[model samples]
Target: ASYSVRRVVKKSKRRYGRKLESQFQHGGSRSLWQGLRTITDYRTPSSRMVNADASLADELNARFKAADNHANGASGTNSVHAERAGEVNTFTTSEHDVRRAFKRVNTR
Candidate 1:
């Protein structure tokens, strides 16, 4: 779940970064403040001026909780069968494993 959340966030940031880069490259704003304002003042369809981070966090939390409930509601026998069906369907990595992998890569 954490991995899924992190992957979503990373993709979102990359997409937003590309958007900002395109805006700066083509928008032809004369000043840094103008460019910043263009980026900051832009509104999406569901844009809100306040508590955006909190709202996004709440939404993601709800989504994750729903997914957890759905997964947990699976019958034990069905879940066992599902687990045996494929290794790719399982989340095999732990936080410790990620940390150790990072450490090894950094040391090298």
Candidate 2:
């Protein structure tokens, strides 16, 4: 039974290694990244975790509200006023400009 288990494990490892190599060879950079992630068993960390109570949410809300208040205080300069002072309030575009922009883009 132990010999069988070892054989199975060896076979699985060989198969996985082959697959990873193939991914790196023919898959380009994206496939290479995927292969690396697979090798490392990589997973994106969750942005938020489940909470048994609402205290976490309440704390986050309070923090965000405090930050908002601080940003809006008299010591903080309004972005809109700064933009107005820079004299870039309006945006203008033309069909020719659009065509030129599109022409500059690579189709591939």
Candidate 3:
């Protein structure tokens, strides 16, 4: 039946997973790397690998900025207003004042 077939497939997958775990535990460094690559599906970069430098980063930033500008151009709702913070008058307190305040506390 289809139910029995599904159970058999699940059991086989579990057995394969256990086999991979055992390989990770008992295998050498090479096998460990192989197992990791297998699990992650890691692939070597092509010859046209991009060097990560400031110029490439700036280009990406500019592209993203242009895209954001284009997307938000139609909707003129991105204005942010800055508010001035209330000024506080400074008051000087001495160590004697701090000690006297601490002494009034009950030490229970």
Q: Rank the candidates by lDDT, best first.
A: 2, 3, 1
lDDT of 3 by residue, 1-108 (tens): 999999999999898788777777886658867877887898878876466789887999877766765776734333321122344558999999999999999974
Looking at model 3, residue 85 earns an lDDT score of 37
How high is the CA lDDT of each candidate model? Answer: 0.71, 0.78, 0.74
- Clashing residue pairs, backbone N/CA/C < 3 A, model 2: none
Candidate 3: regions farther than 4 A off: 49-108
Candidate 2 local lDDT, 1-108, one digit each (tens): 999999999999999878778877775768778768876798989856655468877999877766765776724555545667967557899999999999999984
TM-score of candidate 2 on Cα atoms, chains taken together:
0.35
What TM-score would every model get versus the actual structure? 0.29, 0.35, 0.34
Candidate 1, lDDT over the whole model: 0.71
- Which candidate, 1 or 3, would have the higher TM-score against the true structure? 3
The sequence of per-residue lDDT tens digits that candidate 1 reaches over residues 5-93 is: 99999999898777667767886545544656676785447746565678788899877766765787853334655666876565689
Task: For model 1, give the RMSD to the true fold.
Answer: 19.5
| Residue 13 C-alpha lDDT in model 1 | 86
